[model samples]
Target: MSTVKVNDATLERINELKEKLKISKTLILEIAVGNYHSKFFKKKEDP
Candidate 1:
């Protein structure tokens, strides 16, 4: 599980970007999760 905290201004910006790019909430969330995973695992060298 992950938790994100955004201020009102940031939330508005995200909403605006979502509308402008025509992206859905699900896609945004997936991208965020993928990014988080990559960052979290970046220190471990792959075999």
Candidate 2:
């Protein structure tokens, strides 16, 4: 499990992107994690 903190400005940007992309919060979070994992690990498979 992990935790993340979002400031008001960042939260607002997330909401704007969510609305523009028509994606749910859960999907957005999954995409974010996927991106982080790929960038940090430099691997397609999860650790």
Go through the candidates in order and give the clash count of each: 0, 0
Candidate 2, residues 8-33: lDDT per residue as tens digits?
A: 99999988997977767678999999
Per-residue error for 39 in candidate 2, Å, reads 0.3
Give Cα-based local distance difference scores for all models. 0.84, 0.83
Model 1 per-residue lDDT tens digits across residues 1-47: 65977899999999899796776777888999999999878857564
> What stretches of model 2 exceed 4 Å from their correct place?
1-23, 43-47
Candidate that scores best on lDDT = 1
Quote each prediction's TM-score: 0.42, 0.40
Root-mean-square deviation of each candidate, in angstroms?
13.5, 14.0
Residue pairs with backbone atoms closer than 3 Å in model 1 (clashes)? none
